[model samples]
Target: MSMTLRKRAVLAAGGLALVAALAWAFSPRPLAVQTAAVTRGLYEQAIEEDGRTRLRERWVLSAPVAGRLQRITLREGDAVAEGDTVAWLQPGAAPLLDARTERQNRAQREAAAAAVQRALATEAQARTAREQAELAERRSAQLAAQGFVSATQRDADRLNTHAARQGLEAASAAVRMAREDLVRAEAALAPPAAALPLSRAGGQAPLRLRAPHGGQVLAVPLTSETSVAAGTALLEIGDLRQLEVVAELLTADAVQARAGAPVQIDRWGGETPLRGRVRRVEPAGYTKVSALGVEEQRVKVLIDIDPDQPAAAALGDGWRVGLRILTLRQTDALQLPVAALFPRPDAPDPQGRAMAVYTVDAEGHARLRPVTLGGRNGQQAWLRDGLAAGATVIVYPPAGLTEGARVQARTP
Candidate 1:
């Protein structure tokens, strides 16, 4: 009876050991994961883009009339005061005439001379008629005063005299016009030297172009002395103190930008970032080709540098800088690392898309929880719901992580 009982107990113990080993081998092990604590802090959503500084006001000096422009001595960055002479222009040389053209001019001069003579003859005839009418009018007035002639005859003579005076005035004006025409004809036949002398002393006075305002010379399109037409640009002037930054942002990002938004200017060869504010968001968007050869819609955002800041004085026009426009800001918010977020699978919420994270409980177990997110910056995301401060969330969760999975926190 003792041998049988000992054998049964030994077999049962061996069977129990086998079952325990099998369960130990098949059970799931804890997953190793990185974690970050959710905390309350200031949250800001910003759009980062490259920008360039430019002058607020630029004036382009142009040639007022066609002339020979003098050589400009002023170089770029040179300061000039208001009313300073920036350029000098001499009267352009007259066009040279060929043999045939000279002959034609001579013929025109002869024709003009003949026409002038005809006008003078007509004027002289009108003058003589006017003198005779004046004498008649005087005799009529004298006769009417003496009551020897009728009133009708005196009135008719007076009307004739008035008409004659008008004719004489017209004739005088014609004579003057004739003389002017003759002078113009003679000028056409004269040599170019008579009109515009080659020597500076005898030539017309040179024209002077002065600066309209005090500023630095930005550019000079004309390199050397040359003849320029009217409205040709000569130089550019602008004050460097009034500088504004322009950032080209994607259309999607620009839509979120608003006037008075805070901005940070960086990477402008300065030790500290400069502060600025959004002045404008351009109304229109333009098509641009990206470095990846993709077509994108882009818009411009203008930022005004804080004039009182020390950095403003250090910046100049056309300086390249980096701009971070704060589109959204919250003084107090619950935030978590952006890397911890993952898109929910299967059926999403009513919003059509949902996000979640693997949250670590007090017992060190990973649990999936859907989170309602607000604004998101580059490093952190604001949590509107489904999370609280002091909670731990797994970052870059493993592919096999599931709800209620055991996890071990990784060393920082």
Candidate 2:
């Protein structure tokens, strides 16, 4: 009776051990995942873009008149002072007239002569009328004194005399204008050689073109002597000291940038980041085609580098740089890795704030935590709610990971 009871007990024990071993082997083990801890730290929202350095002001020197410009010896970046003779210009001679043009000029001169004669005749008529008016006014004065005429009539005569004197003065002005016109017409008949001496010394003299500003020559479009038309751009000058940075940012990003915002200038072949401030966000936006063949709206932002900084002296116009404009920043912010967050499209919150992250619970299980997202950058995000500092979150949660899923922190 004792042996049978003991065997039955041993068999039952063995069966129970087998069942436990199978369950341990078949049961899902904890899923290994990378995790990050939510921590309180400094957070910044910034916009980064490529930019170029440029002079704040550029002056393009152009020919003031159509002339032969002298060869410009000054090279780019050459220092120029105010009132320095930068170039010389010889006035271009009048074009040679063809036979038909010569005849036309002669006819025009004759016409001008005739106009002068006509103006003189008109002046003579006006003078005669003025003399008559003055004589009549003298008589009217005498008559008024003798009481032969009413006072009103004498006053009217006096006014007429004054008007006649004005008319005579106008006629004299017309005569002077006619004489000037005749002289100009006669001068036109002179040969080009006669007009070569434009100076008071009766010698051919070239006009000196002086620089209006003190700066370096930025560019010289033409180095050799050549004839240029008026208003043709010849050279460019700009002060390197007056320099600014220009960056084209996405329109959305540009709107967030405020004037006088801090900027970090880097990747400009410099060892340290240069300090700069946003001078302006241009009001206009332009369409730009990106490398991916996408159309994007971009706005230009001008940044002013602190001239007092020694690094700024090394920069020149049109130098490429990397710019990061700090648009927003917060201190002691509760933040976590951005990779920890994911969109919950299947069950979006009513407020449309459906961002969630997998956080490790006290039981070492991944628990889906709905978080109120705030400012975020490429690497990290500031959470407004649903997570506390020191809470561990699963970074880059796998697709198969779900709520209440068992998880274990992966060793580095």
Which predicted model would earn the best TM-score? Answer: 2
* Candidate 2, run of 10 with poorest lDDT: 179-188
How many Å off is the CA of 13 in candidate 1? 11
Report, for all candidates in order, the number of backbone clashes: 0, 0
Task: Let me know the TM-score candidate 2 reaches against the reference structure.
Answer: 0.70
Error of 1 at 338 (Å): 1.2
lDDT of each prediction vs. the true structure? 0.82, 0.82
lDDT of 2 by residue, 1-412 (tens): 8999999999999999999999999999999999999999999999989999998666677775477999999999899986678988877765676889778768867987898898889889988988888888889889888989876566556555655665665565556556655654564565766644477776556767776566899999999999999668888887777778999999889888987678999999989999877878999999999999999999999887765578788888899999999988999999999899888767776654568899998999889888887778889898899999999999999989988999999999
For model 1, state the Cα shift of residue 82 in Å.
1.5
Compared with the true structure, what per-residue lDDT tens digits does model 1 show for residues 1-412? 8999999999999999999999998998778899999999899889999999998667777775468999999989899986789999786665678999889878977887887788888888988998999999899889889998887577556555655665665565555556655665675566766753355567667777777557799999997999998669999987676678999999999988887677999999989999877878999999999999999999999987766577677777898999999888888899999999888785476652368999999898999899888867789989899988999999999998889989998877
Candidate 2: deviation at residue 154, Å? 78
Off by over 4 Å in 1: 1-27, 93-200, 346-353
Error of 1 at 311 (Å): 2.4
* Inter-residue clash pairs, candidate 2: none
Q: Stretches of candidate 2 above 4 Å error?
A: 1-20, 94-202, 345-354
